[model samples]
Every structure is written in C-alpha cells, then in structure tokens.
Target: MSVRELIVLGSASAVPTKTRNHNGYLLRWDGHGLLFDPGEGTQRQMTHAGVTASDLTWLCVTHFHGDHCLGVPGIVQRIARDGVAHRVDAAYPESGTVYWRRLRHAAAFHDTEVIREQPVSGEATRLDTGDAPFTLTARRLDHYVEAYGYRLEEPDGVTMLPAELAARGVRGPLVRRLQEDGAVTAPDGRTVTLEECSVRRPGQKVAFVMDTGLCPAVYELADGADLLIIESTFLDEDEPLALERKHLTAGQAAAAAAAGGVRHLVLTHLSERYGDADEERFLRQAAARFSGEITLVHDLDRVPVPRRRAVVRPRPAE
Candidate 1:
C-alpha cells in the first residue's frame, strides 16, 4: 500500500526543551520524502524516527533561523557519507542564499553532488522538479526575516468504476484502452467513454507553513489541503509576543486552517516556555476556532494525511 504521513522528528521552536527538540518534520508521500526545517539535533532525531538520508528526496527550509536551518550541515554531510545517489532538491528563500551556503558546507566531509539547490523568490512561485507526482509551490510569508511556505498538490484523476465496466462487458485490456484513449469499442461493437465508467477523484494536497505570522500567503498555501503542518509557537495569551516575533499563536494557526478548508491540522514548533503541561491549553485554543481535526505534535509522532473527500455527482434529471 502507498504510504502517506508526516513524521515529526523534532517539534521545539526556538530552544530545545527536555522533551522537545528543535523544528524538524519529514513528510512521506508515496515515493517522495520531504524534510522540512531541520533544526539542531535533527540528524540524531532522524535515527530515533527510523529515517535515513536515503529516504529524503527534497529538503525545504522556511527560513534561515538557527532553530530552523542549523541541521543542514549535518544532514548534507550525512547524505554524502551514506552515498545517497538519488538527486535531493533543496529549496529555501532566495534571500537566505548566504546562510544556506554557509550551513550546507559548514564542515564538509566528502561532499556529494546529488544535492541540488533550488532557491525560491517572489510573492508566489512554482518550483520545477520536472515530472514530480505533485506540483510544488512556494509563497512568501509574514516574518521578521524572509520566509516562504510550501504547498504540494497532486493532479486530479479519474477513479474507474468496476460496476460500470462490468455492465458494458469491458474487461481486461479493453478497460486499459478506454482509460488511455477516453473511449473504446467493446467486443459488442458499442463505444464506451471513460466518463461513463469513472468518477472524478480530487487529488490530495499537503501544506507546510513554518515561522510565519498571519498572512494571505498562509491561507493560500493551506487552501483545501488534506494535511497542513503549521507552526503554533505561542498560545492565545501571548498573541502580542507572537506578533512581535512574527510567529503564529495556536488560535491563529487553527483559524488559517479553517479558512483554507484544511482537513487535518498538525501543529508544531512550540515555544520552549510552554512545557508538556501546557499542551492541552494549545489544543483548547485551537479547537475554539477550528472545528476540524487538530494535533499538537511531539517528537517522533506520525500524522497520517486525511483520506480524500468523497465526490458525489448529482444524477441527471429523470
């Protein structure tokens, strides 16, 4: 079976607490694995989470903050050490190119050429990964420093209806031909169209928003996403501080998820001040605004993307 889930390697915000590590999240979507915001200690965290450098196909950095990008050197060196042959594309705000370069080669030990740098710029940009399973887009966010949010959207497809195919006596190779050509002549000489035997299936979407305050781009990135991994660095009581530091409160993150029609909201990047005891308060604050599913993540937690919404087509007039 195809696996789709978010593995939380580390979930601390600015500092590492006794329980939480710095920000690090790995999104596993079928054949693709995207590592986001690898903060300090992410290399060891990956081992705890049972993920290897080979599992990473893409590396995404929301910003160049020490708590967000400090793990880049270790992860990059590990990739080279492990001899990961597959191309690993890394994307971040173009404004942070200097920081990225410094971190990527901080202490190179036998470097590998498999890592590709694909820095993003502008208000909203579509990344070119060339024939990827989903379309990857980046949008600017409201933060003290330059930051970007990422969205992965799969293309819509048709789900074949076995009943419809059986009714038309279309079996085996004929079904494949109909799907490929949109229409095929059955053995009975009747032409059957793909539309007559399939239902529209909306593709799933996953959004990653980190280190950003309330902004229009946040909503755009989270729009209609099946899963949204966003930072909730503060509770409602600390809204002023959150705004000052360009971070989201739990309520704000949940409100954005609700506005964007996100199905599952995985909240992480919590401030170190809020210990394990304050976790429930975060959930309460978020639940008050967003009725959808919400999760207050911890290190090594796995969050599965919600199942696709069912598409109900209205029958034609009788």
Candidate 2:
C-alpha cells in the first residue's frame, strides 16, 4: 500500500520549550520524503521519529530564520556520513543563498555532492524535480523576511470501473490497451472508449505554509489540498503580536484552510509561551473558523493525509 503521512519532529516557533523543540516536519508521499524546516534539534528528533537521512528526498526551507534552518548543517553532514546516494533537492528562497550556504557547510565532515541547490525566485516558480510523481510549486508569502510556500499536486487521471469494463466485455489485456490507447476493440466486436469505463479521479494535493502571515499565496498553496501543514504560531488573543511578527494566529490559519477547502489541517510551529495547557485554546480558535479536521500537533506526532475524495459517474444510457 502507498503510504502518505506527515511526521512532526519539532513544533516550536521562535523559542524551544521543555517539551517542544524547534520547527521540523517530514512529509512522506509514496516514494518521496520531504523534510521541511529542520530547526535546532532536528537531527536527534529524526532519530526519535525513526527517520534517517536516507529517507529524505527533498529539503524545503520556507525562510532563513534560525529556527527554520539551523539544523541544515547536521542533516547535510548526516547524509554524507550515511552515504545516501540518491540526489537530495534543497529548495529555499534565492535571497537567502548566503544563509543557506553558511548553514549547509557550517561544519562539514566530508562534503557530499548529492545535495542539489534548487533555489526559489520570483513570485511563483515551478520546481524542476526531474520525473517526480507530483508537480512541486513555490510561491512567495507575506513575512518579515523572504519566505516561500510549497504545494505538491499530482496529475489528474481516471479510475477504471470494473463493472463498466465487464459490461463492455473488456477484460485482461484489453483494459490496459483501452487505458493506454483511450479506446480498444472489445471482445464483442465493439469500440469501447476509456471515458465510458472510467471516472475522473482528481489527484491528491499537499501544501506546506510556514512562517507566513495572511497572504494570497497562502490561499493558493492551500487550495483544495488533501493535507495542509501550516503554522499557527499564536492564538486569537495575540493577533496584534502575530500581525507585528508576520505570523499567523490559529484563527487566521483555520480561516485560510476553510477558504481553501483543505480537508486536513495540521497546525504546528507553536509559540513556546503557550504550554501544554494552552493547546486546547489553539484548537478552539481554529475550530471557530474551519469545520474540517484540525490537529494541533506535538513533537513526534504523525498525521496521515486524508483519503482521496470519491468521484461518482452515472452509467451511460444503454
């Protein structure tokens, strides 16, 4: 079975608390594993979460904040130490090239050439990931510093209906041929079209929005996403502070998710000021706006992407 989930390594915002570390998230989508953020203690946190350097296929940094990129050096060195041969694409804001370079080579043990620097520039850019299963796009966000949000979208395809195929007398190799060729000669000497036997299946989508305030890009990234992992750094009471710091309050994040039609909202990057007791407040604030499934994550929590929406098509007139 194909696995799709998000593993939370750390969920703290600017400061690390006794329970929460800094920001780190690993999104597992089929064959690809995207490591997002990777703050101070991410290396050790990965061990606790049972994630190795070899599991990472992409390193996505939303911005150059220390709490978001400080662990890049350790992760990079670990990749070299573990001798991970596969190419690891690192995507970050192009304006933060200096910060990225310094963190990438902070204390190199044996520099590995496997890491590919794919910087994000312009307002919105589609990343070239070379035959990746999904299309990855980055868009600029509203933040104090230069920041970007990422969205992964799979191409829309069709789901073969066994009943429809059986009715058309299309079986075995004919099914494959019909799917590939869009039409095939059925065993009954009739032409069966692919559209007649399949229903349109909208592809799954996952969005990552971190360290950004309310912005149009945030809505674009989260639009129609099956899973939306976004930062909810403050509660509604601290809206002023959140606005001043260019961070989203729980209500704002949930409003974005509601407007974007996100199915699963995994909120993280919480401020250290709020302890374990304040978690419910975050959930309440978000619940007031978004009716979808919401999760205020903790360190080492795993959130699965919601199952795909079903597409129903009526049978053609006989």
Candidate 3:
C-alpha cells in the first residue's frame, strides 16, 4: 500500500529549544518524498525519523533562512555518499541563487546522484518538476526575505463503479477499454459509455506555506488543500511581534485555513517561548477559528494526508 505523510523533523522558529530543533519537514507522497525547510540538524532528524537521503526525491526551501535551508550541504553530501540512483530535484526561490549555490557546493563529494536545479522566479507559476505525476505550483509569499509557498495537485480521474459493471455486463478487458476509450463495444454487442458507470474523482491537493505573515498568497496556497502545513511562529498574544517578523500567529494560520477551505491544518515552526505547557493554548486558539483537523507538529511526528475524498457511487444502469 502507498503511504502519504508529513514527518515533522524540527518545529522551532528563530530559536531552537530543548524539545524542538530549528525547522525541518519531510512530506512523503506516493513514491515521492519531499524534504522541506531542512534546518541545521535535519540529517540527524531524518536518521531518527527512519528516513535517509535515499528517500528524498525533492528538496524544497521556502526561503534562504538558516533554519530553513542550512541542512542542504549535509543532505546533498549524504545522497552523494549513498550513491542515490535517481535524480533529485532541488526547488527554491530564484532570488536565493547565491545562497543555494553556496550550500549545494559547501563540501565536495563523489556526487553520484544527479540533483536537478529548479529555481522558482517571477510571478507565481506551476514549476516544471520533470515528468512528475502531479503538478507543483508556487506563489510568492509576503516575507522580509524573498519567499514562496508550494502546492501539489494530482490529476482528476474517473472511478469505476462495481455495480455498474454487472448492470452493463462489462467486465475484464472491456472495462479497461471503456475507461481508455470512454466507450466500448461489449461482448454482447452493446455499446457502453464510461460516464454510465464511473464518476469523476477529483484530485487531491496539498500545500506548504511557511515563514509568511497573513497574505493573499497564503490563502491561495491553502485554497481547498486537503492538507496544509504552515508556519505559526507566534501566538495571538504576540500578534504585533509576529507581524514585525513576517510570521503568522496560530489564529491567523487557522483563519487562513478556514477561509481557504482547508481540510487539514498543521501549524509548525513554533516559537521557543511556547513550550509543552503552551501547546494546548496554540491548538485552542486555532481550534476556535478552524473546524477541521489541526495538528501542532512535534519533532519526528508523522501526520498522514487525510484519505482522499470518497469516490462517488453512481446508480447502476438499467
């Protein structure tokens, strides 16, 4: 079975605490594992999470913050040392070209794995991830530094209904033919249309929004996201500080999730000031605004993408 989950490597913002590291996340999606915002100790965190450089297919950085991309050198070298067979894609804001280069080549290795450079520039647009099964889009976020948020969208497909098979007397290769051709001539010499049996299965979407204050881009990235992982660097009590630092508070993150119709909200990149004792307070603040599932991520915590929307079961054909 395929597994899709977001592993929280580190969850601290600005400062690392005894309980939390700087910032890091690994989003595991069917055959593709995305490493996002890999902080200073991300490599070790990955070791703890039972993941390795071999599991990384994409390295995504929201910006050039030390806590967000400092682990690039280690990750790159680790993959090189392990001789990762497939190509890995490193996607980040184009404005950080200088910083990216510095980290990419921070140390030299045999460099067996081919890491593709996919820099995000200009207005928000869908990035080219090279034959990826899903679409990867990015939007510029409002932050003190040049930053961007990313969204993943799977393609819509048709779900075949089992009851419809009996009704239409279509089975085996005929069913596949109906799906492929949208219409098929059955063994009984009857023409069947794909729509008569299947219903549209809307694709699933997941978004990542980090290190940005409340902005249109935040909502855009979160819109209809089945799972949205965003930075809630402060609590409502520190709204002014959050605004000054270009970070969102828990309440703001929840409000954006509600406004964007997000189904699952994960608030991370917490401030060191809020310890275990304050975790409930952050969740409560967000719960007051968003009715969906909320998770205040902890280091090494793995949160799966909620199951895809149920497939519609159309009535059997007469």
Candidate 4:
C-alpha cells in the first residue's frame, strides 16, 4: 500500500517551547520523502520523530530565515555521517548561495552522499526531479525577504475496472493494449474505449506555504490541493501583529485554504504563547472559515493525507 502523510518534526515559531521546537516538517509521499524548513534542533527532532536521513529525497528551504533553514548543515552532516548513498536534492533561494555554502561546509566531516544543489532565482520557478511522482514548483510569496511557496502535483492515474473488462471479454494483452492505446477492439467484434470503463480523476496535489503574508500565489499554489501544510503563526486577534511581521494568523490561513480549495489543512509554526488548547481554538477559528478537515499540528504530530473522494456516479438523464 502506498503511504502518504506529513510528519511534523517541529512546529514552533522563532522560539522553542517545552513542547514545540522550531519549524520542521517531513512529507512522506509513497516511495520518497520531502523535508521542508528544518529549523534549529532538527537533527534531534528527526530522531524523536522516527524519521531517518535515508528517507529524505528532497530538502526544500522556503527562505533563509534562521528559524526555517538553520538545520541545513546538521541535515547534511547527518546524511554524510549515515553514509546514505542516495543523492538528495536541496532547493532554496538562489540568492542564498553564500549562506548555503557556509552551511554546507559548516564543520564538514568526510563527505559520502551526493547532495544536488538547486536554487530558486525568481518568482514562479519550476524544478523537475525527472523521476519523482510530482513536479516541484516555487512561487514568490509576500514576505520581508525573498520567500517562496512550494507545490507538488502528482500525475493523473487510471483505475481499471475489472467488471468492465470482464463484460467486454477483454483480458491479457488486449487489456494492456487498450490501456496504452485508449481504445481496442476485443477478440469478440466489440470495441472498448478507455473512457467507457475508467473515470477521470484529478491527480493528488500538496502545497507547502510558510512565513508569508496573504498573497495571490499562495492561493494559486494551494488551489485544490489534497494536502496543504501552511504556517499559522498567530491567532486572529493578533492579525495586526501578523500583518506587520508579514505572517498569517490562524483565521487568515483558514481563509486562504478556503479560497484555494484545499481539502486538508495542517496548520503549523505556532507562537509559543498559545497553549495546546489554545491551538485547537485557533484552528477552529480557521475551520469556521473553511469547511475542510483541519489539523493543528504539534511537534512530532503525524497527519495522513485524506483519501480522494470516490468518483460520483453521474445521474442518468431523466
């Protein structure tokens, strides 16, 4: 079975509280793992969260914020220390090349694994890993610095119906032919079209938006995403402070999710002032604005992606 889930390694803002650490999230998508914004103490947080360096295929850094990207050196060091042979792709702002260089060589040990360094130069940058299930796109967000939001979109898939095939007497090579050609004539003189048997379902999509004020691309990247991991740093009462800092409050986050047509919203990067119960309240405020599933993420909390809704049977014309 393919597993898709988000592992919240840490979910604090600038400060680490007794329960929450800084910003760190791991997105496990089937065979690959994507780690985003590994803030301070991420190396230990990963250990506590039961996430291994070997599981990471991509490392996405939204910006050069210390609380967001401070763990880069540690991650690289750990990967090299573990002797994992797989090449890890690291994406961040191209302007941070100097910072990246400093971090990459920060107290380096014997380098073992290959780390591919790809940087985002401008707004609306797209990077193709060539073999992953989805394409990674980065769009600029409204922040004090050059911050970007990342989105991953998996390709659409076809679900084969056994009953439809059986009724057409289509089996073995004929079925494969129909799948590849979209239509095939059966052994019997009957013709089968792919559309007749299969339903058109959209592909699964996930977006990660952090440390940004409300922006149009935030909605663009998050639009109709199956899973959206967004930063909700403050409650609605602190909207002014959030706006001054170019951050999103819980209500704003929810509104963005609602506007973007997100199915599941995982809220993170919370202020330490909020208690556990307060987090729930803040999330509920967002939930009030958006009618989808909401998760108020905590350190080490795990959230599974909601399964896609089954195809709705079209009503026959009266």
Candidate 5:
C-alpha cells in the first residue's frame, strides 16, 4: 500500500524552545519525499522522525531565513555520506541564490547525489518533471523577503466498474476488449461501451504555505487542497504582531483554509511563548472558522492527507 503524510520535524519560529525546534517538514508522498524548510537542527530531527537522507527527493525552501534553511548543508552532506545515487532537486527563491550557494557547499563531501538547483524567479513556476501523479507549481507570497508557496495537484483518471461488466454480459475476454477498444461486441452482437463501465475520478491536491502574511496567492494555492500545511506563527490575539512581521496567525491560517475549501489544515511555525496552552487556543480559533480536520502540528508528528472516497460503480449484471 502507498503512503502519503507530512512529518513535522520542527515548528518553532526564529527562537527555539524546549518543546519546539525551528522550521522543518518532510512531506512523504508515496515513493517520493519533499523536505521543506530544514532549520538548524533538522538533521537530528529527521532521525527522531525516522527519516533518512536517502528518502529525500526534493529540498524546498520558501526563502533564505536561517531558521527556515540552515540545515541544508547537513542534509546535503548526509546525502553524500549515505551515498544516495538518485538526483535531488533543490527549489528556492531565485533572489537568494547567493545564500543557497553558501549553504549548499557549506562543507565538502563526495557529490554523489546530483543536486538540481531550481530557482523560483517568477510566479507559477513548474519545478519537477517525470511520470508523476501530480504537477508542482510555485507562486510568490507576501513576505518581507522573496518567498513562495507551492501546490501539488494530481491528474484525473477513469475508475473502472466491475458491476457494469456483468450487466452488459461483458466478462472474461470482453473485459479487456472493452478496456482497449472502448466498445466491445458481445456474443449476442450487443455493443458495450467503456463510458458505461467507468467514471472519472478527480485526484487529490496538497499545498504548502509558510512564512507569509495572509495574501491572495495563499488562497489561490490552497484552493481545493485536500491537505494544506500552513505556518501559523501566532494566535488570534497576536494578529497585529503577525501582520507587522509578515507572518500568519492561527485564525488567519484557518480562515484561508476555509476560504480555499481545504479539507485538512495542519498549522505549524508556532511561537515558543505560549507552550502547550497555545495549541488549544489555536485549534479552537481554527475550528471556529474551518469546519474540517485541523492539526496543531508538533515536532516530528506525522499528519496524513485525508483521502477522497474512491469512485465506484455497480458491477454489470449477468
């Protein structure tokens, strides 16, 4: 069985507390893994989360903030140490090319894994390529520095129906024939169509928005997302501070999730001042606005994307 989940490595803001580290997240999607905002202690956090450098396929940085990207060097070095042969794509804001270069080569190691440095210079950049289920798109967000939010959307596909087979006397060879030919002629000369035996099922989508104040792009990228991982650095009471610092409060993040039709909202990037008491407040505020699943993420916690109901049709009658 395939698995898809977001592992929260660290969730603290600029300051780290006894409970929280910094900003680090590992999005595990089936065979691929996307590591985002690897903060200072991310290398150790990954161990606690049971993740290894070999599992990383992509390194995504919203900006060059030290708390958001300081662990890049350790991750790169570990990839070399483990001798991962597959290519790893690193995506970040183009304006921070100098910072990225410094962190990427912070320490020398055998360059076994080919690091594909993809800079997001403009809005709506497609960063990945392959026969993957979804396409990754990045959009600029409102931040003090250059920052971007990312969305992953899967392709739609047709779901086959077993009940429709028996109804049309389509069984055995006729099943394969109908699938290939779209229409199969029965023994009695009756024609069965593929359209009658299948239904189009839309694939799920996931988005990540961090280190940005509430903006239009945030809603755009999060629209209809099955899972939305957003930074909620402050509680509702601290909205003023959030706005001033170009960050998002819990209420704002939840409101954006509600506006975007997000099914599951995972809030991270918490301030250390509130501690355990803060999670309830954040959850209450979010639940008040968004009527979906909400998770106040903790360091090394794994949150899975809520799966949509699989399309099913009645099997064909005899």
Candidate 6:
C-alpha cells in the first residue's frame, strides 16, 4: 500500500559542498508530496534522487535563507514546464511575501498560475488543505529569521477485528454495514455493533523542524511524532557557533527529539565541513541523547515513517 517515506534531496547547511548540495527534503505521504526548503541545485538533486516535478503537491519554506529557499523559482518553473495541472500549495512566512514574489517569478515561463499562496502568519496556525485527513500546522521557531516548523497528525481510527465480527456472526456485506453505520443486523437477526469488534488505533504523525535553535516550538512540533526530520547544523564542539547563528547542534536536536517523544529522528542540514565518514559523530551524539532510532540524513536518502503503535488505551481492565 500506502507509501509514507521522506526523500532527502540535499542536506548541506549554510553552504553547498562537492557532495552535499543544500537543504531540500521531500515527504511522500500517500497522495501528498510535501517538498521542504528547496535550496540551490534542488532541481538537479531531485532529478538525481528520481523525484520529479509531478511528485510535488506542496512546497514549504522554513525561512527566506538562500540555502533554504533559493530553488523556489526553479521548482515553480519546472513543475509548470512539466504541465503540472494540479494546484500546488506554497507556504512561507507571511511577512516575506515580497521575497516570495521575487522567487515566484525569478524567471517566468508560461505561468501555470496554479500555485496557491498559503502563507504562515504570526504564531502557530493551521494550513488547512481541506483534502488530507491529517491536520497541517506551522509553528514559529527561534531563528535569525522568521522560520517555522510543520507537523501533520491524523485522527485516531477504529481497527475492526475479524475474530470479534466472526464471534458475533457478522459476515459478508453486513460487516461493512456495521462499520459504516456503527451497527447493523446480521442474518441471525442479532444487532452487531462496530464497537464490539473494533479497537482504537492511534493515527500516525510526523513533523519537520529545520533552521532553528533550541525552541519551544521544536518540541511542540515533534511532540509524540512517529518521525521527526530536524536540523542538526553543527556538532557540540561548535555550540558557540550554533548559538551565534541560531542553529542546533547534534546533541541539542537529539535532546529535543527525546523530550518530544519522537520515535525516529532524521538529522539533516549538516555542515559541509563534516565528511560523510564524520557523520558517525553526529549519530553517536544523538544516540547519547536519544534512545530511539537515529539517522544522519544524506543526499537521496529515503527514510520510511515508523509504523503506528497499536493503542490499548481502552482495553478491558484485567
């Protein structure tokens, strides 16, 4: 089935290196393709990663930093060039509308005119797509610029148990009716209720936090998320630089993930000075702070969302 994974197109922080391009990530959530922070060369990076313009459904910019949003013009133009008929929603800080306009038309081809401007205003607010089952929201983060983090949370659903239905003599289309109507009469003339055959299943949740220092919203966005993609711009040795630049060290990011109860942490936006081989240091730093799964996001890396934990909240008391 349903595909849920993140595709890292680029993972460099502040500057691009020979190997790392810039900050760019794509979260493939079923029918949704949320592209985050299309920095320079993101178009080429996407091509290398086997991601296409047609794959994008939303473009989210964390801030106006060039390394974070420079590829906006290219992304908009390429999607239009490929004749993307569907409207793509673009979200960014509302105060940066001028910069957005500059990037939107940096170089105009035939404008598809399908890009919806869903800007994030002051404070944390929902960017209601009115389509996806999960609610999408952006919360302001602590950074040198106006940056925001994104989160998606699906509502809890009922998981029907076949054994429970069979014991109740609910079979065939009657079971479907019971699910849809929450109750139905089987051929045995007994009323079967959906609650008797189903258990509550907690919905999956994921969050993206980038280009920010230690902040309250970082934990807010990552709170109880199944997967969290966050910026780890420097190692602890560079804590001074991180604080000066309003960026997070690997340890800080991992601590935030741990505090937020994130199941999987994918660390990105690494400094180019750190080699791929040196990535293990970041991993070890995160491991020291968080017990859950940790990843050092690299170019073209794909991280699948962790499976939902089965909820037993309403189980009958022993």
Give per-model TM-scores: 0.97, 0.98, 0.96, 0.95, 0.93, 0.96
TM-score of 2: 0.98
lDDT of each: 0.93, 0.93, 0.90, 0.88, 0.88, 0.90
Q: Which portions of model 3 miss their true places by more than 4 Å?
A: 311-318
Name the TM-score of candidate 5: 0.93
49-91: candidate 6 lDDT, tens digit per residue = 8988998999999899999999999999998899998889999
> How well is each residue in 21-107 modelled by candidate 2, as lDDT tens digits?
999999998879999999999999999999999999999999999999999999999999999999999999999999999998898
Model 5, runs deviating above 4 Å: 172-188, 310-318
Give the per-residue lDDT digits (tens) of candidate 4, residues 137-241: 999999988888999998777777888789988899988898899999988888899877676667889999999999898899889899999999999989999
Over 4 Å off, model 2 = 315-318
- Model 1 CA lDDT for position 44: 99
How well does candidate 1 match the true structure in TM-score terms? Answer: 0.97
Per-model clash counts, in order, read 0, 0, 0, 0, 11, 0
Clashing residue pairs in candidate 3, if any?
none
In the range 1-318, model 3's lDDT, one tens digit per residue, is: 788999999999988999998888888888899898888999999999999888999999999999899989999999999889898988999999999999998976776548988999876977776777789998999998999999999888888888887888999998888889999887788898998888888788999999997888999999999999999988899999999989999999999999999999999999888779999999999999999999999999999998778577655599
Worst 10 residues of 1 by lDDT: 307-316
Residue 272 in candidate 4 has what lDDT?
80
Residue ranges of candidate 6 with Cα displaced over 4 Å: 313-318
Q: For model 6, give the 10-residue run with minimal summed lDDT.
A: 308-317
Tens-digit lDDT track of model 5 for 1-318: 778998999989889899999899898888889999999999999999889998998899999888999999999999888988888888999999999989988876776547888899787799764776678889999999999998988787767788777877889988888878889987778888998988877788999999998888999999999999999899889889999999998889999999999999999888777879768889999888999999998888889878765666556799
Which of 2 and 4 is the better model by TM-score? 2
Question: In model 1, which runs have C-alpha deviations exceeding 4 angstroms?
Answer: none
Comparing candidate 1 with candidate 4, which one achieves the higher TM-score?
1
Clashing pairs for predicted structure model 6, backbone only: none
Best by lDDT: 2
